[model samples]
Target: MDLGFSQATAVIVGGGRGMGFATARCLAEDGARVALMGRSPDVLEQAAAALVEFGSPDAVGVVVDTADVGQVEAAFAEVGERWNDGLNVLINTVGPDAVGGFEDLTDEQWLAAVDGGVMGMVRCVRAALPLLRRAEWARIVNFSAHSTQRQSEILPAYTAAKAMVNSVSKNLSLSLAKDEILVNVVSPGSIASEALVGWADSVGVDGSDPYRLMEAIDEHFGHPAHLPRAGLPEEIAPVAAFLASRRNSYMTGANVNVDGGSVFT
Candidate 1:
């Protein structure tokens, strides 16, 4: 059961909520020192406290704006100083979903998606490079969405940006192979999270019952997955944990889909 992550240090960008928080809990439960980096001070504090409660007493909350280059650099530097040992894993889950059709999207909207989705990962990876190099083994797990595989009319720009992220991850995998640093991507499909619940509420669906909300989403958005319903954050966390662990020594540049059979390999 021990994935050998007890002493490894993981920096999770956007670790305050949803899948990021779930992944944080996974690593922490396996005894990793986790630093949650996000923009919200309160959420970061609460998340870090929750991690500590989950058995990672050394968990830290790092407030960072991924879109800001300076903040990203400073945050990583602080993580290095705080951990002092090394950074074993870097998980970039900070990205925005741009809704609306291609024609409805303005130049500003397109740029926003690129800036938040693509450039955010770029900045985080650049900042974490030095710390990651210090570790004996390093893993970079980036987030993409299943929407890239099954295009959505409402998410053209977002999907394009995620495709770019997947491409960049593959390139990084090749470039970092010599260093023995593994780089990969995780594309999740319709994972039940707070955002989804809010979405359901906005559309007059019952948010209290997650399954009902998921069903509503599937009805509205069409779930092509073999599974009957949406996935939970916990369901996606274990895959990310394994990918971020030393056990995943051979898998690199692979975009693993946690989409409940919605995406075919």
Candidate 2:
């Protein structure tokens, strides 16, 4: 399927590893020029190099901590300088996953999660709006969690923050519809990522194999999703790529769930 992404300029926040990196590769493979922005220069460079192997050698990396507005603005400026004038796709994936029960969380923890997850997306979307509006067609894909609707017991801060993301996406979709810039959220079930592994380790279940813990959690949680197994980063990437492409013309203000039917709305 041609996604109509060739020659498109994309900016992927937190594109160093896990789902962000996977999405970067997917966009690059579809012939988009991607600028990978993350906190770690080393990791971002490595991801960029790998993308070059699969897509455009011109794929670039920028070190930017999304938590800091100054850094994010500077990174977007760098992207503009490197890739023509503006971006066609802006995918905000820079936040950390929150764990722990409500009582277990500290004030600092809750604030950090809100700042990183909610405020970070706000800053990215605000900064990228000018560039996105420059394109005839643009997209902003915000990463959210299925746990928000599922009412997962733990991760109160994360869940609340993600819910805000969904709200923000819907609001922005309506505001940006006139500009032809589609904004939407993608909520995924437990995808195999480093964040999930870290959450498992923090729960005192230590082992070299994290998938076991993932499976155990899914089983205990009733595995409501139709798919038997957890999703892969690759599996989630294509949906994001399609959303960001000019091909997805009719989807806006919608929270598309790609959780193997885990979220049947």
Candidate 3:
């Protein structure tokens, strides 16, 4: 169960909060050197500080909007400067959800969903390529959604974008196989993130009570899993952490679903 992350260096995109922060924390606690990259400087700092307290004192937070090419390049440049040799892991976990249906969704909304879901991961992988190539071992874990596999009419654009992410990630796994870099996608179900918690609160549901909030999710979004409750961000993080770890040697081009039996493969 060591997972071989003791000396690993990781860059977690959107590592400021929720599942991103949870994964970063797992790695940090396991003795990995972690760098958190996110849009908000404050959130990144707080997350990094928390990871530092978790025993990754060298943990740093770099601010960058994944949507901006220049910002991503700059942020990775800083990462390269800080950890000159290479990068052991790259985790992208910032895909946004677009709630409108096909006919009701605007062009701008579709564009944003694609940008956030697919292009963001593409940009980070581009920026991290050189560093990954230099590493003795490398792994890439990209977060997608279960909606792509199960099909959801409510989030067509979001699901489409995630589908693209899954396809592109599989291609990347094959492309990077020559370098022995394992690349995989993690498709999670209705995770109780801050936004979901806020939605539950808006509907007068207690987000802290997992069963109640999950019932609310089933009633409102119709996204209930077979486990009878929503999954926690912490629950989803460990799966991604394993994929990003050196222990995951043969798993590539696979979409690991950490959903609570939402989609049967």
Candidate 4:
């Protein structure tokens, strides 16, 4: 579990809060130099400071909206100037969750979902490729979702975008293999992040008890994992850290599921 992360350069999109912050914390704790990218300057600043407290020597924050290609490219250009050579890891956690049912989704909503879920990751990866290729050890970890595997009627745009992510990740693994850049995907089940917790509370479901929370989720969203609980951001973070580290050699073109046994495929 050392992850061999000492002095590695990591850039995390959406690293301001939630699972993104959780994963960046894990990397920082293992001695990675993390650059957190997000829209909110305050959140990014707080996260970078916390990463330093967690053990990162050079944790920095950059403001960027993944929806905008210009912003994403500019952010990476700044990171390139800072690092001066290469990026060891690129982790993207910016994506849209299910908003409404198919009947409820407007053209604009669907477009937004694809922009956030698929193109967001694509933009980051495209910008980071040069740095990654120059790296001594490079890893790309893209976030997908368990819903992509099990299927959710209410999550059409989100699921479709994640499926595209999965497909694109596999292709990148193959294409980037020659450069020795490891490209993989992490598909998590429903995790107890801030948004999920707020949604649960809004729906009158208490997540205090794991089993009961899962039961309520089953009744509400029909998303009950075999483990019978929502996953924690901490639980998903370490797996991502491993994937984004020097220790993960020979694993590529794979979608690793951390969905509490919800996805058999």
Best by TM-score: 3
TM-scores for every predicted model: 0.97, 0.92, 0.98, 0.97
Off by over 4 Å in 1: none
Model 1 per-residue lDDT at 8: 89
Model 3: per-residue Cα lDDT over 122-221, one tens digit each: 9999999999999889999999999887776788998999999999999999999999999999999988999889988988999878899889988876
Q: Of models 2 and 4, which has the larger TM-score?
A: 4
Span of ten consecutive residues with least summed lDDT in model 2? 205-214
Per-residue lDDT for 95-201 in model 4, tens only?
A: 87657899999999888888889999999999999888877889999999988888777888889989999999999999998899999899989788788777677
Q: Which candidate is the best by lDDT?
A: 3
Clashing pairs in 2: none
Expressed as tens digits, the lDDT of each residue in 1-265 for candidate 2 is: 8898888899898888988989999888888888888878889888999988978558889887788899988988887777665789999876656777899999888988889899999998998888888776799999998888887667688889988889998999999999989998888887767866666567665423645655656754444566655677888898888888889999988888888777678
Q: What is the C-alpha lDDT of each candidate?
A: 0.89, 0.82, 0.92, 0.89
Tell me how candidate 2 scores on lDDT: 0.82
TM-score of 3: 0.98
Model 3 stretches astray by more than 4 angstroms:
none
Once fitted onto the true fold, the runs of candidate 2 whose alpha carbons sit more than 4 angstroms away are 198-213, 219-224
Error of 2 at 231 (Å): 0.9
Q: Write the per-residue lDDT of candidate 1 for residues 25-118, one digit (tens) a residue.
A: 9999999999999999999999999999997879989998888899999999999899776799999987776888889999999999999999
Looking at model 3, report the run of 10 residues with the lowest lDDT sum. Answer: 146-155
